[model samples]
Every structure is written in structure tokens, then in C-alpha cells.
Target chain A: MSSLKTPSTFIEGPTRLGKAELAALVAADIPDGAFVNLGIGQPTLVSNYLAPDSGVTLHTENGMLGMGPEAHGDDVDPDLINAGKIPVTELPGASYFHHADSFAMMRGGHLDICVLGAYQVSARGDLANWHTGEPGAIPAVGGAMDLAIGAKDTFVMMTLQTREGQSKLVEACTYPLTGVGCVSRIYTDVAVFLIDRDGDHGGGGDGSVVVRETHGVTFEELEGLVPVPLRRP
Target chain B: MVTITQSALDAVADIPDGATVLIGGFGPAGQPVELIEALVETGTRDLTVVNNNAGNGDVGLAALIGAGRVRKVICSFPRQHDSHQFDAKYRAGEIELELVPQGNLAERIRAAGAGIGAFFTPTGYGTPLAEGKEVREIDGRHYVLELPIRADYALVKAHRADGVGNLTYRKTARNFGPIMAAAATTTIVQVHEVVPTGAMDPEVVVTPGIYVDRVVVVPTAATPRPEEDQ
Candidate 1:
């Protein structure tokens, strides 16, 4: 039993890191030449920091493929936008098509990574991003369910805690579920954690996803790097 | 216990003609009949109704078609009931039909809820669905980004509810209710029954009250005719 106990591993961030640094943490783990989806909110920041030299292709559910990060003011294309209605820049090789095919790719499991914003993430990596019913807010769920289930790997970006001081990471989600057993990892302000499935709770699958604390380094700095001596505790 | 009132009807009482409503259903399977009946009884007209399918001719959402309330329908399939009014209207072009693939319909609704301006996919690529749309390719795969679809009003059904308006559907009926709940500017629910908080099994509750704005409880009549029965 003593041998079974593992020490909790923590990725320490520098005192404080902004959104860009956090996004780079997410972008760093993505491999070269991958098909990716950048969801609304923090997930969108990833494109801005993806290694300009990497051959990664970004797909927007709205219809743009090979989307580049945000463009300079002079480079903005009026017709180029993400799911969030934010204007975006297209890569040199980017192309557009009817929106139907975009979702098909999502549902078809052709994506390598899809980064999304989450309202809560369960320990098992379940995501809930659709509706919190905030006052006067539109009650919409969007493509959260499809993305959560369709994407090959679902990575979530969110704060460790809510404004009211509630932890977004829970043993189980109180919100409506987008996809069952679909979350892969979580990137939060405090730290990054891989949702492990091997705990004694006896769920399905081994916990293979890796989570590390981003103590403040940019994803650019962390990409291609894994902890030298991973502490399983 | 949650109690529904006639006052709930007030919400749809003033809808003007030529309204575009996003109704929930893949036919009688999940359509909200009480609300459709309310719309038909209210005599609202020229409605461009968006749904997964038109309901059986005389039951479910088809009641609106029977009453000549739906001026058009944007959906994937039509209920096969021989008496379906929407089908006749659609065939005569008396009602415009904008057919979307089932998955596409769900995605467009979700896209609107996510606040996405537009997106592309290969589902409708190279087909009529691609006409008049920009085409793009990435990594040798072609795709088309679609604009999100939003509706002025969305009407849905729930099996049970609480005073706070959280909801849960019986089973597979949970289907498009959750999606439609998120894509509308104003969301109203017609519940078969209203229950007290904590009475429903949290595990079974599908739609949370947060997305629901208004709800009305009326005793549900007999089940709508199923497509298989037709």
C-alpha cells in the first residue's frame, strides 16, 4: 500500500502570467502538422502564440481552415472570423468552405487537438461549457457537446476558481454534461493537470494524459518539453 | 411543487406575423406539442419554422402546418404521415423548405450559442449545400465555414421542472431540447409536469434551469404518432 501512494506533481508558475503565457502552455504541447480547433475564450489565444514555424493547421467551426493567429490591424480580413465572431487572419495555405463540412470534420474525428473554454472540469476530464444561466445571458450551449465528443483530444482552459470562489475542478460536474468521459487535460491559472483515469475510484481506462503546473512560463517555452523526473505522487 | 399557470401563455401572445421560430424536435420524437398548439391556437402566421423534421400531419408540430401557421420550414426530414400539412405546403412551395443535414442543423444551432461568427466543414462540401459559400482547404482537406443560425424564439418540451425552471427530459426525448434551449433569444418550455426542487434525480436532469426563461405546465395528451407508426 505504501508503494502504491504517489506524490502529487505540481508545475509552478512564476508569480503571475497573463493570458498569452497561459495559451503558449497549451500551444506548446501540440505537435507539428496537427489539425486543431481553437474554441472561444482562452482557447483562441493559442493561435497567436503557436510557433510561427510549426506546420500546425487551425480549423474554426465557422468554416475557415488553416487559420493563422490574429492578424495585424492592417492584415485583418473582413470576411475571416472564428466561431466567436472575432476577426482572424488566415495562413498562406488557408481555405474556406461551407460550414457543414467543418462540423463533419469535427464529428468525423479528423482533428488532432481542440482547445476549448470550460465552465467546469470533472476529475475524470468531463467538460461542461454550455450554460451557467448567468443573469440576462442568452441560454445557449453552442457546439460544446460535439466538440467535447468529436475532437480527438479535448483540452480545457479555465480559471482554477470561479468568481464566487467555487472550484471549477470538482469530483463531478453540477452543470449539464457536454460529453461523457471526453476531457483530456486542464490548463488553469494556478496549475495544469492531466485528468487521470487510473485512480482507485475504478473508472474506465488508464490515466495517460499528463498535467503540469505552468508556474508562469509561456507555452512556447514548455512545448516539446516534459518534466525530466515525473513524480507520480 | 412547481405550478404552471395560464399566465405563461402571455409570453407568446403578442408574437407578430412572419416570425422565424426555432422549434425543438426531430419530428414527434421530441417536439413540444403544447407550445405548437398554443402558437396554432393563437393564430400566428407566416412563420418560417426551423426544426429537425415536421411532425406527423395531425399531431405534434404538424398541428401548426394543419392550421396554415407555418409559412416555411427549414429542417432535415418531414414526418411521413399521409395527412401531414407541412409536406403538402412544402411540395406546393406554399412553404419554403431549406433542408439541412441533421448534424448540420445541430451544429448551426450550437455555433450560434457559442457566439461563433462562422465556421467551415466538409459535410456539405461540393454539394448544393456548398453553393454561394466560400471554400477552403487545409492540409489537403477541403472545408467550408458556415455562419451561425440564431432564432428570435425557441420553444421546447421538458418532462419535469422546478420553480427555478431547471428541467429534465424522460429519455431519448432529451434530444434537441438542450440545443434549441441554447440558440434562442427567448426560450420558453412547455412541461408535462412541474416538480419541487430536489425531487428530480440530479443524474437524470438534462437541461438546467439557467438556460430556461419561462415554462408552462399542461397535462400532456396522448403521445404523438411515431414515424415508425406512419
Candidate 2:
């Protein structure tokens, strides 16, 4: 991420997981029998790592459940496109509905988990992915806000830092927020954060975030880069 | 109560300029391409249109937007990789946009069709999208009041329709078609095929004929059309 900085002499041979490796890690963590919706961008790659026999159902916002992988030459149907407008295939047990029912599946808490790509995620689990709030920028919210607050657990997939080496996991999001305290976990290149929502840190911004795992960087190094404090889960 | 039309031009002929219309599709999936192309041919302008995305590539809704027929677009996501037509017009301030969250867009349309006046949702709560809206705490959670979106006409594409105009869509393409059909004063549809009355099972009809006003059959792929000779 952001031109891997020259590591200090403290940690020897620190290595980071690639996108595929990180997706595989995320896939392995998903429990079977969960109904999931993966946001359009990099989060779509997680389906590749999921086992075919896995009972997880893919829900595309366009209007279908049991969505399969991308379509091939003969299988391509212009009418069978996903939320990203890319042609896709339908798996067994796939069902179609109107946009109202499709969104109801999400906003009604029927979806177990949703993985979304993010620009910034607050330590308190606030999400800011819809609009960047730049001048003259045409903002498009799509289903990001509904998915963030609707799913039982919202998971964010993104690099921990931006291209300028600014930490994306920040004390607060400067951009327009998608939801407040909605994120449950963040899967990144170097670390996985598990937010303790049950902790009695009400309105204190002291979220007691747990560093479940770390890659490439040591715990202390991560803490130094992160704006918020982290403890081992 | 639906009329079976022979052509897209004839199907959408009565839609007046400046009328509010709901065009169904999430990208090109359920888009009424031929009907929109005919509307472009009709030179209808100053229209308010609603859909999911603004447009995709250079056909269907994109063509309508590029032709300057739309005065405004109320949609969820109006920006995409291939949405250059909308992007350019939007940047030039030639078109107006009312961006709604995806769920709100759908539910608002659904509310209109279901005769609901207004409803509250928690989607944009505490966000900038909720600014200046009526907010109330329901069950300790905040919700914003959203009004229904109604239109004068709705154009949709579907897989099949019965002689009486009961409609069924193919796969993911069913999105917004049924609700838009109900939300509009006149709903026109373009389908690949039309079956005889009673041929479609009552249990299988996604949109009943009562919601549909007109049905036109436009075969996809390269079906040669007769020259528009006066």
C-alpha cells in the first residue's frame, strides 16, 4: 500500500498479504449457512475464495439471491446483469424479485453479513464510502448506506492507508458518513480489527478496538501508525 | 384493459413532452431499449426521468439523456465507468439530478405504487443525506421521512406478456419493472413474446395486466425493422 515504506530495523522480514491472500483469509473466516452480499468492487473477489460447497448465498442488489460467478461466452445474458452492470450467471436455488423485495432483504436484517470497499472507517465503526465530499464531485450512494446499516454485521475491505500514507482507519471520517457505528470488522492488507461494540465506552470515542491479527508490521509499529489505540483480542 | 401495440413508436406515441416518466432498469438489464429509442425519435424533451443508474454506454437511457430529452434525472447512482453521456451533461449543468439512496429510491417508488403517502427509513440517519429532512426517533432509532415518487408514465422491458398484458421478467431484469408499472399513470412495456389469454399461469405473473396499459413486442438481437418511410 502507498509504496511500502522502508521498514525500520526493529522487525525482521515483515511481509504483507496480497489481495488474493487477504480475500482467502476473509473467505475462510465466513461461517457456512450465512447469507452474504458483497459490494461491487474489490469485495467481489471474495467469491473466488469461497468454496463451491459452501452454503453462503450471494445476494446482488439488482434483484436476485444465489448469484453465481461472472458469465462466460455462451452464458452471457444482457438481461442477467448484476448491480455493477456486468453480465453474470444464476446458480441453483436462485430467485428473482422486484427492487423493493431485493432491498427489503437487506434493510430488514435478513442478510447476515456484507463486505464493502471503503475509503475510511472510523475506530468507532463509522463508515464513509458513498461520497468523498470534494468540490463538484458527483456523489453516488447506490446501496452502500442501506447495506452498511441493514446487514447484521458490516465488514469493510480496504488498505489500511491511502496512497499518501495516511491511515484510513482514523479517529473520525472527514468524508460524508454512510452509517454510524455500523462496521463490525475491517479486513485489510496488514491487520484485522474487531470492534468491541459491547464495551461501555459510550460517547467517549474510546472504542477499545482489538487487533485480532497483524501482518508485515509489529503490534507496536501498527499502533504508532494508527491514530487510535489497539489491544490484543 | 391493456392495448396490444404493434410497434414501439405507436406504444409510446401518447406520452406528452415534459411528462414525468419512470424508466425501469438497473443499467441495461430491464431497460426498454426500443421504446426509449422510439421516444428519442419522437423528439420528446423536457422530461423528468427516474431510474437506478443515469445511463450506461450509448444506448437506451444514455441515448435519451444525450438527446437532451431529459430535463432532470432522479436516480441512485448516476456515475459509472461507461456513464460518460450523463457525466458530461451533469458537469455542464445541463441536466438536474436528485440522487437518492438505492433502497430509498426503490421503496419510494414502491410506496407510490402501493398508495402509501410517506414512510420513514433509517438508511441515511445521521448522514448528510438526512440533512433538513423530518427526523423522528422510533423505538430509540432515528428515521427520516421519505415521500413516494410518482410519475405520469413508466416504460419497462420484460421477458413475456400475455394477451391481456400480464407480465413476467427474466432473472435479475425484474427489478423496478413491477413497481414502476404500478407507480405511473400509464405503463408501457416491450417484451420478446406475447402469449394468448389464460396461457400465463396466474401464480406466475409478476405484474398483472391491470398495472400494464400497453404491451409491444420487440424481439431482441437483429430483427429487421421496416423503413420509416412517410
Candidate 3:
């Protein structure tokens, strides 16, 4: 055995937080007794990082509440799955309902927080996660639209920039909007930011974006990459 | 006397061409595979299917779409990782698609069951999904007017059913089954077991007999299929 030695390589560029670290950062901010819904992709990892004793209840849009972390190996129950179609275990006091009833809980503003992955988030908090507006792109809207507008706080968990280094946090989203001014905070690999209405009652009171936290990148460095002016409050 | 059919083929024989059908399941847990296979065997054409996702692999709705029986699909998530059939058909312009938000899709079906003409929902408020739809502002929040969606037929799978069609589903497998049963003009269910009318506890029944129009007993997996030997 080669002992699976860790490789030491030097690359000169801005370091970004890994997926697990990003998830842990988002999970730390969730308060106890909060009703939360985790979106399908990278945001689903947030559930795994929640404090073991925390009373946070996870809601799946496919008619389940109090969902636990992803089930593994022999523990996987095919019937008990999450919105992502992965087998999951039910937490204590778990309850199941109809699909419409689950969405009612979502659209009824019963969720305290919802973390989602986005293609782009505008400075005014407009979310565009479903379709990229590219021709021939399969548009699968899923539960994103409902969760974006329904949750009390919608926190986006994604990389700060695209693989091509295009900033996802922009002045205005070029993609089709999922919800207007609905995003509360964004958790990217490089930094975390809280979105607010730009200016003093401009653009329906949806205005500038501000930085709240940074990982390896400085606030100024992150702001330099974004399309919009970043306010440091 | 419950309307129980011995043949899955006979249960779906009455479904005509160009029918809007509601299929129950999240992925494959509660899909009426036998009924779908029977419908495929019957060669019903130009079907408009309504479901959560398109289908999995080469079974269930995907098989039907692969056979070119589906003319259109109205669903929330139609393109899954393994949904190559739908992707191929959709890209080829062989089948039409009406993408709906998941919550909106479920609520539209539920609204049909509840006899609601239309209702305003905040799901697709400011997105492209809200385009060409009526928008209203109540309490300074915008909501889009969504109409009820009814189907000509509903094919659902249940864990068990009473003789009179009272249904109780297993765990998370119960998704969209009860609502689809109520939202269609003719609802047909495939179940593993059928008990006596009063055998099931009243509190456990998810779908009442009144909503269900037909019931069929599905063969258990332990029993071998005749085709398997061939």
C-alpha cells in the first residue's frame, strides 16, 4: 500500500472553501427549533452539519417532515426518501403528509430557513436558479420557486464564481428569475453576504448587497469580483 | 360491492387515446407499473401525462414515452439524471412539455380535487413561470393565479385497499397517490392486498372509497411472471 499520501501542490489563486466547510458554516447559523427546508443539490449537505442535539426540523417537499441525514448502506429505506430521491431516515416525531400539504407549509411561511443552490443571485436578491435562459436547456423548476419566496430566510449555498470565473453574484441576473428580491443571504465558497434593498427606496426598495463574512478571500477581493458595488457595513 | 378487476389490462382498457392521465409516484415507489405496462400493451396514443418527474430508467412512464405513446408531459421535474427517454424525445421535438413548479403542480391537482376553480399562490410570483398569468397583490405580496388541473384518468399505487376502495399507503410511498385519485374523472388503483370493507382502521385510510372509482390487485413480487421464463 502506498499509504494514500496526501499530495502537496502549490497553486497561486484565491482559495475557496470546500463543500463540507461551506455547509458547516451555514449550519452553524441555524437556530434551534427552526423549521428548515434544504434544497436538492449542495444545500442538502447543510443537514449533515447541524448540531446533533439541535431541534431543527427538516422539511422535504415530497411530503415529509423531521427528515434526518442521508441513510447509508443497510439502513437505507427505499420508501423513506427525501426530495432529492435519496434514501433518508426519519427523525423522532417525524410526520408525513400529502404533497400539497407539504407545499402549503412551504408557501404558508412556516419555514424559518431554506438553503438553495443558485445559478445567479442579483444584488437586489432576485434569484435565478431554475433555468439558465440558454436555448435548449431543460428547465426543471422543481420546488425552488416555492422555497425561494416562502421561507422567512432564503440562504443560497453555491460557489462564489462559475467554473469559468464568472461571478454568480451580479448587478442583475441575466438568467430567468425564480423569485424577485426573495433571497435573504448568500453563502458562497469565498464569502457570505446579506442582501438588502439598494439605495433609499430604489428599485422597489431592493438595492445593494453587503458582505457579512469572508473565508480565505478578503472583503475587498470578493467585492472586486462581483458585478455590483459591495457595501461593507 | 367494490369495483375490483382481476386483469390489469382490463382495468386500463377503457382509457382512450389523447387522454390526460395523472400518474402517482415520486420516483418509482408508488408508480402503477403494471397498469402502465398494460396501457403500453393497449397502444394508447397521443397521451398527455401529468406526474411529478417524467420517469425513471426504461420503466413506467419512461417506457411509454420511449414507445412514442406520449404526446405531451405536464410535470414539475421531467429531466432527472437517468431520464434519457424524455430528454431524447423533448430535444427531438417529439413530445411537448409544460414545466410547472413542484408546489404549484401539487396544488393545481389538489385544487381540482377540492372543486376549486382557481386560486392565487405565491410560488411562481416574479419568475418566468409566472409569465402570461394573472398577478394580484394582497398585503403587499404578489401571488400568481393558478388554475386547477384535472385528468381524464388517474392510475395510482397503494399498499393496501379495502373492498370498497379505502386506501392506506406505505410510508413515503403515499406521495401524490390520494390527491391523484381525487383529481381525475376516473381513478384506478393497483394495490398489493385488498382487505374486507371494515378490516382497515378508519384513521389509517388516506384515500376514501368515494374518490376511487376502480381497484385492481397487483401480483406480489414473490410470484413469478410467466414472461420471465421466456
What stretches of model 3 exceed 4 Å from their correct place? A1-15, A197-206, B221-230
Question: Residue by residue across A77-195, what tens digits does model 3's lDDT show?
Answer: 66678888887888889998888888899888888899999999998889999887788888888888999988888889989899999999988898999999888788888877777
Encode model 1's per-residue lDDT on A125-207: one tens digit a residue. Answer: 77777656555332334455556667778888887678886778776778766555677677777567666544532223443
Tell me how far candidate 1 lies from the true structure as C-alpha RMSD in angstroms: 21.0
Winning model by TM-score:
2
**Residue pairs whose backbone atoms clash in candidate 3:** A197-A206, A197-A207, A198-A206, A198-A207, A198-A208
Candidate 2: share of reference interface contacts reproduced: 0.73
Q: Please tell me which model should have the higher DockQ, number 1 or number 2.
A: 2
User: What is the fnat of model 1 with respect to the true interface contacts?
Assistant: 0.01
Model 2 spans with C-alpha error above 4 angstroms: A1-14, A200-205, B221-230
DockQ of 2: 0.47
Off by over 4 Å in 1: A1-106, A110-233, B1-8, B79-83, B201-204
Worst 10 contiguous positions by lDDT, candidate 2 chain B:
B221-230
Each model's DockQ score: 0.03, 0.47, 0.44
TM-score of chain A of 1: 0.78
- In terms of lDDT, the poorest run of 10 residues in model 1 chain B is B221-230
- Per prediction, fnat is 0.01, 0.73, 0.65
- Classify candidate 1 by CAPRI docking class: incorrect
